[model samples]
Target: MLKDIVDVLADPVDGTPLRCADDLSRLVSESGHSYDVARQGYVTLAGGRGLNHEGDSAEMVTARELFLSQGHFAPFVEAVTERVAEVIDKSHAPEPVVLEVGAGTGYYLSHTLDSIDGSRGVGMDISVPAAKLLAKAHPRVGAVVADAWEGLPLLDASVDALTVIFAPRNPAEFARVLRDDAEAVILLADQGHLDELREPLGILGVKSGKLERMMRQAEGYLELVGDAELLEFPIRLDRASIAAQVGMSPSARHVEAGVLRERLARLPEFMDVTARAQLVRMRKS
Candidate 1:
């Protein structure tokens, strides 16, 4: 699977091309830097100082897998896939490359890949735990662990379509990596996305002006393609699903496990939760 998107990869240190070496046990860059591939079939492409952040813990990745596998975010995934399909058709790339930054569990990337023919994906995340699942999530995907804030381990103008779902974004880096006419489809959870659970679970709330702030951050590098679309849906989740949802989010880090359990126990067995997010399409300026 690494071979599928190897051409899109670059040395994290010097931005040179990389290729499989020592029978695919490691990746060697054109600049002579070496990065070992893990036995789990994923590669860590960090610089000399190594990764600055551990994207997600194993427990969080597990929770995400459990929650997403049950199709709680089906609408979000479908909307992403549909937008990507449209972008690919307009780009007309024969073998388009789709890169998902902070791609947890590779769920979104794999789903988008399945919807498009002759498409390859780079599931890039900073988490080793997430990369392990991303490696086997799809046959056409290559999983890589690299910090987004530092700089993506990818070649300039190499990616055709990029997706960031409730993940970090380096707008300048994104603009550099995306080819002309290519688009980056981003999804951000809007305020009141989980109003029902916020009060009950004692979780943090999404603040307003998120989009304006994001656009300001992207100024001069990436431009909004069209009006941001609001996707709102209601999902019926049982207590376990609700737990998984909370466990996989930033709320997990803030709330104590025992306290969260106690709060979850007081809620109804089945409750309807609203999932609301804004999807924005952007391209290089």
Candidate 2:
């Protein structure tokens, strides 16, 4: 519910404190900006320029939910939760605040919140469909629809830990919103991630120099805590699960439905695919 994380939310336009009003049907900012809460239990916190990016579609979101529900990415989720817990403990926040940017379906945020006591999360995404899922993903999560590039609609120095899993990153904004000792956990797709499915599925490949580029982008905002941790594991996926994985990625848009089905049919009934990614821990600089 919006009331759960209202204290951590801010006006998208001016960063004013926000509170539920009109019987919790809307959120009123201290600056007099009113944002209506959807009956479905989520709020859209776009600023004057409005959201310029479209996040994952409902179909894509559904595919993600399906794939993640099977616990195929358990290792990924575990790494995130472990690091987030450490950050919260180090900060000694009585009421820890975790924010997930571009949080899709709130799966990761939900899991992290479950693992940490006295912690609440703000799941911010640009998709309305994602917001609907996020609103109910967990009891302690407040869902908001906003453009990440524009800047996060959160108060400065309000978040104890921020996690971005296969999502967008706003380093400067993250630094501004994080306390000096707060941590940021980021997961990036390594070059070998899902290599088994790439050629057959005609999917996009992880670009080279991604880590270097990311560090350059975060030059003044953050610094690496230690070394990047590699989280690589193998999973046995059937044809159906493989299809769901492809559908949730950019490959779904590049291939025709019928042709993609043909390609999937030629694959083995079950395959051992490598799921690889690097987890980088950073602290505000």
Winner by TM-score: 1
Candidate 2 similarity to native, TM-score? 0.98
Q: Where does candidate 2 stray beyond 4 Å?
A: none
Candidate 2 lDDT, tens digit per residue, 157-184?
A: 9999999998888889999999888999
For candidate 1, the TM-score is: 0.99
Clashing pairs in 2: none
Q: C-alpha displacement of 185 in model 1, angstroms?
A: 0.3
Can you give the lDDT of residue 16 in candidate 1?
97
Where in model 1 is the C-alpha error above 4 Å? none
